[model samples]
Target: MAFRYLVGRGKDRILVDTGNGNAEYIQAFQSILSTRDLTLSKILVTHLHPAHAGGLDPLSRVTWVSSPTIMKHGHSPRGFPNLTSIKYTSLTDGIIIQTSDGDTTLKVLHTPGHTRDSIVFRLSEEDAIITGDTLVPHDGAASVVLEDPVAYLASLRRLDALFPKLAYPGHGDVVVPATDLIKRSIEEQMQLPERIIEALCSGGGIMDARDMVRRLIADAPEEARRNFTGTVLQHLLELEKRGKVRKRSVPKRVPSAAYEERDPDRIKGPGGLTLAQVSKLVKESRAKDDKVYGLKPVEKSQEKGKDFSGAESGKSGKLERSEVVQLHPAHRELEPLVEVVWSVV
Candidate 1:
């Protein structure tokens, strides 16, 4: 199914994240909108994920728009030509889009970690934020996947500053205390890079992204590990792009044989290594029964004076870190570190 929303002041029917794929997804989307007696005027893509944007194919007459980053990826669906215009709109930070119902302010917070163009639009008057993959709520935690951690962190801070009343994500239920959720999301994200850097400093040295994910998975809770895998990988990819860590291969790939890798043992420290090399290290290390360095837990801070401090004491900031933990499909040992990471963050 696709996720479409009626947003803006006039309830100006704009479909967000048009679940673009087969006709079935689109049919379901239209069916739902029909039930509400609403017709979409425009399609605002949250990002480029197939599930979120797949419904665009079935939307024959609507205008489709998204961040410039998504436009860069190019549109390929058969029905794309039917779209009035699949234009790229630069969502200026803090800019607001006025609708008939009320002003649906477009606080263009570029949260790029999940993808280069990922953004969260905060509707100030409504006290709600339209968070793409930028914020996923799970087990009372705010989880995020980023294409650019720096950008993602900045966006989180902006959201935390705005403290929206609620968050309606691309997927899942709406978050009621949007401000708190944003805060937790930020805190959770802040903990990841620190863990990676810490592992490197503590003789863990530089490591490949997959190994880093492996370490995290061993420590995370069973249910959360898979999500953690994607989260950590996204963080690692961002780090690699930033030159914080090096990869063995320019375009890394996993071999059919191995599950993990390390930076220090297989490649030059501060240099780089490939996924294959890292996987070798993981296999050898497993043979030796050694623990891989992983994310350390972030300590929860108490907001002594805020009205919500008591309920939020020891709770994660903007995004919940715990919910992001999930084991990589192959590496099973990183669960504990995941737990530690969530507990602290």
Candidate 2:
């Protein structure tokens, strides 16, 4: 889910993020301000991501503000799935916007992690931070799609040092005692290196980064899958730098062996249909998402007539595509991803 935040002082008003481009959501935002007699004068987006700034086009007449990174790339960062068409001013770190006779202040903190343009606004009056995707709730941590894991950790550390008490994230409700979440995010990231090493110990091979990503994502959810490789790749780079793991080739994109079972029957979505069938339903449905639970792999004795999706497979199969598959609605929206965990190093 996406979110739009309304921050105002007296009659002067603004929005923190624009949610999706959903017309109803935007109308409700405007209507809320109308009943309160506040005009939507300015919009400060944490980033130019469609989910956060999609309404910038429809909600004309408002001055827009975002990070220079968004404007620098022509509002279209490379690899960003959907970019918004918006003309916006650039925001910098530690800049404060004093609202309405200077009683309440918006402290714009340029905290880039999830995206190069991500930022946070600290409402001085309530000591609440509007953290757009930078520091999302863990239970709601699907929003933590990392661009650069190194920078992400640094940003989280900076937020930790600030001693924030409350947070309003990009996709979730208020995060009380925001420092706890910040520290937890930091802890999770720091442990990623160890996790990768442990995964490596589970198997043996001179593996490329792409294959390594497949191994790491065996237990990841659909939401976590998007940012999974980028996060894993960056940490692998770190591990290599420390001599914990070494690359096999000069970073050429070569074919890798299958790391997981790919039984077609195992890959299911809405109503437990195949991915292809789910794609059709997704185009016709308005469901954002629903709870998707997975079951453990079926016993080896039950594996018959099940070729590896399109290949032949036999015993010691850790899982079937169906047993560990997570059926969710939104996976259909993404393109088929065969990402490069390493940039052809």
Candidate 3:
């Protein structure tokens, strides 16, 4: 259910991100073309996701433009049925599109992380940006489904830096003051890692991703649960990279591995917030008048220490704060916090 846009001046028309390849979408697009007196000339895909690229087959005669990264994966031929007639163009950071008369121009911005191939089209003439799922505006808030938390956050910051006057996102109504929405999205994402840490710490020191998802969005509708789970997992992976948390691989008999807080006393997170500060902020955000969601830590079982190692019986092992090494190169700039001493049973 992604939105596709038709941009044109005179007879030169460009289609942005085709919707699902349903016959209805094709008919509707044709009707729009007929009503507007604009012929389909080219397609600009934001990403290679099915809902966004599905209609490419029907419009195969036109020139297609997308991320070079996506093209390497053979999206043009395998994903679209009629690649024989389509002329594929790979775009990077600075590709520009000019109308035949040269009045309107659209610049491509490589903004990956909703997918590795996501891009945004910026129409400076209109002060608008056609953002794919890389940045979405929903209910006066920006939403994102991140494939990589670090990349996604960086992309959001990049969009904010652009200071677009308006945003025509892939889904939802056009957002005014687009930079503000991007900023809000960044703030929300920044808080997610801390929220995950707090959730893990509150749940008797460790919990699997599924358990964290359930606790975080206990009241969310069924459709939203899957997306929330993905967000939780992404944050956990990032936290693990920062050495704020560690993943304990469970035996094959278990469905998922458990994630444990590396340091319960002083949980480090993005923006230098400790666990207590993050918990307070979360509680304040959810508070109504004097009422706030109670963040009581779940009762710790006698087996809490044993569970940390993912073994039935073992003394919990500890690593000196200085000895902890970050495996992810992206987190090299992140400074490890104070000494972490894990208690043994």
* RMSD (CA, Å), each prediction: 16.0, 12.5, 10.7
What TM-score, computed on C-alpha atoms, does each candidate reach? 0.56, 0.65, 0.66
Q: Go through the candidates in order and give the clash count of each.
A: 59, 2, 0
Among all candidates shown, the one with the greatest lDDT: 3
Error of 1 at 150 (Å): 1.4
lDDT by residue (1-345, candidate 3, tens digit) is: 999887766776677887877887787767777787665555778877767877666665333332111221123222223323344777678778765557678898887667667788899788889997877775321134555778778988988888899999888888898888898888888887777677666654544554465556655654454555555656666676677876443211111122234343375444454544434443333232123334332232333334434445443332111122232222222213211211101
For candidate 2, lDDT tens digit of each residue in 1-345?
567777776776667777666878767766776687765455678877777777666665333332111221223333554454456566778877654445567887777667777788889889788888888776523335576677888989988987888998886668899998998899888878877776554333233333444456646654565455445556776777877765432111211222234433356632345443333332222111111222232222343333324344454433232122221222222222222122112
Of candidate 3, the 10-residue stretch with the lowest lDDT total is: 336-345
Model 2 earns a TM-score of 0.65
Against the reference, the lDDT scores of all candidates come to 0.50, 0.57, 0.58
Runs of candidate 2 with Cα error greater than 4 angstroms are 61-77, 81-86, 139-143, 208-217, 250-345
Model 2 Cα shift for residue 106 (angstroms): 0.8
